[model samples]
Target: MYEASDLKKGIKIELEGEPYIITDFEFSKPGKGQAIYRVRMKNLLTGYSIDKSYRSNDKFQPANVSNLKLQYSYFDGTNYVFMDPETFENYSVNADLMEDKKDYLMENMEVDGTLYNEMVIDVTLPSFVEMKVMRSDPGVKGDTATNATKPATMETGLEIKVPLFVNEGDVIRIDTRTGEYLARVSTK
Candidate 1:
């Protein structure tokens, strides 16, 4: 059990019999009233989010989540498959559950999978991923003067606006959170 005042980002707890992860939290102490906590929580299983407030003394039971380090094996066309490094057991997750993570995941990449009561709830891909550009237009010779960007497709079929200097066949770093291009990675 934990008090509302102890809530922090990444903390998991149960509310209304559903497991949720605290994405952001703020503690507010009213000058003349009671202390309250405002939290933005996302459903661990469904990916839904809501803003809720709790009194300082409100107690909650921490949700039990099993986090495992898994290796991306291969996709079965419909679902992406991952294997537990420890047990060598494989698990397949639906594409909808993977959402934005699909852009960053490559063959043999390592990712973290969250399980609620042993049921896979979510998968977190790396913050930054290296992917090769599969398609892009030619850059203008003097386009480097301004902060211009051109759309490029990565090997995973994800399109992102990369700098004008980028070209097809170039390996670039991508920011997974915003699905933006970071920079070109040196082949050397």
Candidate 2:
């Protein structure tokens, strides 16, 4: 259980039998009223967000959430599969839950899997990943005079802008959060 005073960003709590992670939190003491806690939370199961307020005396149940290190297995036509490296247990997550993240997934990649009530709820990839450019247009001479970029398709099929010097077959580091090219990595 958690007191309203314990509410803060990143804290997980249970409400109405569902788990929620606090995304934002603020405290206020009205001129004539008791202290209130304003919280914005995201439902772990549904990915829905809500804003609610509570008094300092309010209490909340702690959410049951766990993190596991899993390795990317393969994507069946319908679902993405992950495996626990130690136990060799397999878990499947729906495509809808992957969304844009599907673009960054690579076979054998290690990621953090968030579990709620023993069910996989979410997966977190590494902050950066290196991928080979499958296709890219050659940069024109003198294009380097300014900060120029060209579109490159990664082996995963994710398209990103790379510096003018980048070419097809080159490996590049990408920032997963922003979907931006970080730097070119030598294949050697």
| Candidate that would win on lDDT | 2
**lDDT for each candidate structure:** 0.87, 0.93
State the displacement of the C-alpha of residue 104, model 1, in Å, after optimal TM-score superposition. Answer: 2.0
**Ten residues in a row with the worst lDDT in model 2?**
141-150
Estimate the Cα RMSD of every predicted model relative to the unseen true structure.
Answer: 3.6, 2.1
TM per candidate comes to: 0.76, 0.88
How many pairs in model 2 have backbone atoms within 3 A of each other, for residues 3 or more apart or on separate chains, i.e. clashes?
Answer: 0
Q: Which stretches of candidate 1 lie over 4 Å from their true place?
A: 1-10, 22-41, 49-60, 142-144
Model 1 — which ten-residue stretch has the worst lDDT? Answer: 179-188
Local accuracy of candidate 2 as per-residue lDDT tens digits, 1-188: 89999989999999999999999999999899899899999999988999999999899999999899999999999999999999999999999989989999999999999988878899999999999999999898876566788888999999999988888888999999999999989743
Clashes of each: 0, 0
